[model samples]
Target: AQSVSQHNHHVILSEAASLELGCNYSYGGTVNLFWYVQYPGQHLQLLLKYFSGDPLVKGIKGFEAEFIKSKFSFNLRKPSVQWSDTAEYFCAVNPRLSGGYNKLIFGAGTRLAVHP
Candidate 1:
C-alpha cells in the first residue's frame, strides 16, 4: 500500500532554534514528494517538492528537504525557526498512476510550537 507517515505529532522549540521533522512514505515506484504547511487560520501552502531532477529541494520560508530514495523518506529541515513558524506540517506524496492527475496523500499532522 502507498501511504505517508509523519513521526512527530507535536513539537516545541524556542525562537532561532533548528527544526527537523521526520517524514516517511511507502512506495516502490516513481512518486512526487511534497511538504505543505498550514498556519493558524490559513490554507495549506507548499513548502517544497521533489519531482524529477534533484534529490535535495528547497522551498519557501527557508525550508528544505532531502529525498532519500533508499529510505523512502523526505524529511523537512530548517536551520533556524521563529515563533511565526508555528503551524501544522504535513508531508504528502503523489503516486503516479495509469491516468488522471495524481492525488496528494498526507500524513496525520504535526503541530509545531515555537516560543519567542
Candidate 2:
C-alpha cells in the first residue's frame, strides 16, 4: 500500500511571490506522480505529471515539479504567483501494481491564497 502527504494545510502569498508546495509519497516499483488543482468551485484538474522522461516537468500556469524517486517526493513550485493562482493543490500517486488495476492515492490538499 502507498500513501501521499502534503505538508502545508494552507499557504498565503503576495502577488509575484514564489511558491513551493511540499509533497511526499510512499511507494515502490514504477510509479506515476501527479499534481492536481481545484479552484473554489471548479472541478479538479491536472497540474503536472511525472510518468517517465525528464524528472523536471513543466505544467500549466507556470507550475513545475521535480520528481525525486529516492526521496519519494514530488514538490510543486511556481517562481512567481499571482492572485489568480489561489487554489487548492493535491498531490497524488499511481504506483504500478502487478495486478491489472492501478490505484490513485491522493494527499490531503494544500489551500493556497494569493493576495493582490
Candidate 3:
C-alpha cells in the first residue's frame, strides 16, 4: 500500500536553530502534499500544503515545504525554530482518486523538541 515516510523519528533542537524534516511518499501520480503539526495537548494544525501551483509552498508558523516531484519528496524546512515550535510534525499525501475523494495517508511523524 502507498504510504508516507518521515526520515527523522525524533529531533532535538535549541531555540533559533535551523530545522529540516525529510518527508517522502510512495505514490508516483498526481498528489497533494501537506505538513501538519500537533502540539502538546493540542489538535492537529496545518503547517503547510502544496497543490498544483508552486513547488515551494509556505505555510503558517514560518514553516515551508518544497514539493520535489522528481524525488517524490515534500521536505519541510524552517530557517529558525523557536521553543514554541515543539510539536509532532506529520507529512501527509492525498493521492488523486477516481471519485476525487481520497483519504490522506500520513507518515509515522517526527517528534520535534525545541529547547530554550
Candidate 4:
C-alpha cells in the first residue's frame, strides 16, 4: 500500500510568479504518479503523470513534473503562473497490483490562489 503527501496545503501567488508544489509517495515498487487539478467549479483534470521512461514529463497548461526515484517524489512546477491557474492541486499514486487492477491514492490536496 502507498500513500501520497503534499507538502503545501495552500499556496498564494501573484501573476507571473513561479510555482512549485511538492508531492511524495510511500511505495517503493513499480508505480504511477499523477498531478490532478480542479478549478473553482470543475471536475478533476489530469495535469501531469510519470510512469516509466523519462523522469520528467510535461502536461497541459505549461505544467511539468520531475520524478525523482530516490526521493520518491513527483513535484509539479510552472515557471510563470497566471490568475487562471488558481485551483486545487492533488498528487496521486497508483501502485501495481495483481488481478490487473489498481486504485489511486491521492494526497490531501493543495489549494492555490493566484492574484492578478
- Using all chains and alpha carbons, the TM-scores for the candidates as numbered come to 0.97, 0.96, 0.97, 0.96
| Alpha carbon lDDT of each predicted model | 0.94, 0.93, 0.94, 0.94
Give the per-residue lDDT digits (tens) of candidate 2, residues 1-114: 689999999999999999999999988778898999999999999999998999999999999999998998999999999999999999999988878465789999999999
In model 1, what are the clashing residue pairs, if there are any? Answer: none
For all predictions, the C-alpha RMSD in Å is: 0.8, 1.0, 0.7, 0.9
- lDDT per residue (tens digit) for residues 1-116 in model 4: 57899999999999999999999999878888899999999999999888799998999999999999999999999999999999999999998777656588999999999999
Candidate 1's C-alpha runs over 4 A off are: none
Candidate 2 stretches with Cα past 4 Å from truth are 100-102
**Candidate 3: minimum summed lDDT over ten consecutive residues — where?**
95-104
Compared with the true structure, what per-residue lDDT tens digits does model 3 show for residues 1-116? 78999999999999999999999999978998899999999999988888898899989988989999999999999999999999999999999977898589999999999999
Candidate 2: C-alpha RMSD after superposition? 1.0
**Candidate 3: misplaced stretches above 4 Å?**
none
Model 4: lDDT equals: 0.94
Model 4 — TM-score against the truth?
Answer: 0.96
Q: How many residue pairs clash in each candidate?
A: 0, 0, 0, 0
